[model samples]
Target: MVKKYRNFKEVGDAVVIYSDNYINDIEGEKLEDLCASYMERGFTSIVIDFSETDLVNSIGVSILIGIIEKVRDCKARIAFSGLKRVNYDIFSIVGLTKHIEIFDTEEDAVNGRVPQEMVTS
Candidate 1:
């Protein structure tokens, strides 16, 4: 399926981006552009809610990496929430977990509550 770029919502200082069921090469650029816009707007925190995203290809991972770079450039914090087990593994394998905090739910991510199980040394 052709994925489209969904709109994001603002939660205080954070901007939350909701994802579709799948993230592929097509959605990557859109995500990047959306994040860039948010950064331009002076948003310091970003949360990517993947509650509906069940699959993420290599291109999608690369896209996320690009987003991470943009967030880092602005010295902003970014978090990921609602990731499935498989998707979590993908993020772990790609070293995203080292930079972005992962949460089991959007509320937890937004509230900055990292699940005890997800906390790493």
Candidate 2:
């Protein structure tokens, strides 16, 4: 099961997405759909939480990359939080972190405590 923790703040114009399993194929799709739904509702910012999720596959990685592209195309922004060391290393190797903003906490990610960038690949 995929669980989400979210906080929508008017001032920040952000939505935080918390997930315990960050990389299940079905869950990843659900998260993507959820983000798209929010984008349709005028949300311009996003934060993804992955501290509890320690596993990922190519499909999962692809989903995340897709999210980054979609948000960028819309001129919106996104941050990631609670990344486990293993997943973080994978993301780093892929250069996803270089482009996608990441925070150690949900608050920081959603509140603009981090700088935004583009995906390297």
Candidate 3:
């Protein structure tokens, strides 16, 4: 299915990327741009809302991985929120859950406790 790409919002230190469509390589580029722009603007922490997105392809996963690496370079972090069981499984299988944090809600993502690695770094 060709889903229409939706826009994203920047809230405080979080950039919420919400869309029902799947995010592939092309869309991943857009996400990368947003992350870079936010970092350039001095925002470090980010919460990517996947509540509306049901699926993410390999390319999308690569972009997310890239986000993790980029955030590490900036000594920052990215939180994934509202992921379904299957999506969560994907993250776990890829060992991304250890690298990036996940939360049940946006509030939890922003206000919830962070991992020690994230805090110490």
Candidate 4:
């Protein structure tokens, strides 16, 4: 099933991408395209708010890896907020947490309030 997502919004220096209930194969490509567009537009900081999302499949994880590659190439920063425990574990197991920061709230991500130890170069 296709997952729903909101339009990307600018929040200070970061752009926020809000995903819906689930992220699977169908939603992966769309997310990849959206993130590519943002990168093309010179957006260096991004926050993906998963407050409404609880599940993600392998395809979704792959898409996120693509975004992380782009972010690293641009020497940019990307963070995730409001991730459920399971989703958080998935990200960690995939080693995404090493490349991107995770926050308890969208506000913390947008405000660059993440702990120094959690911040990646």
Question: Which parts of model 2 have CA positions greater than 4 angstroms off?
Answer: 1-12, 113-121
lDDT of 2: 0.75
Window of ten residues with lowest summed lDDT in model 2: 1-10
Stretch of 10 with least lDDT, candidate 1 = 112-121
lDDT of all predictions: 0.80, 0.75, 0.76, 0.78
Model 4: lDDT of residue 103:
85
Residue-level lDDT of model 3, residues 17-119, one tens digit each, is 6544677887778878888887887877777878877788888898889987887788776888889888888888888887778898866876666688875
Error of 3 at 30 (Å): 1.1
Residue 77 Cα positional deviation in candidate 2, in Å, after optimal superposition: 0.7
Better of 2 and 4 by lDDT: 4
Misplaced by over 4 Å in model 4 are 1-5, 113-121
The clash count for each model shown is: 0, 2, 0, 0
Indicate the residue-level lDDT of 15 in model 3. 64
Question: In model 1, what are the clashing residue pairs, if there are any?
Answer: none
Pairs with steric clashes in candidate 3: none
- How far does residue 75 in candidate 2 sit from its true spot (Å)? 0.7
Q: Candidate 3: where are CA atoms >4 Å away?
A: 1-6, 119-121
* Best lDDT among the predictions, by candidate number: 1
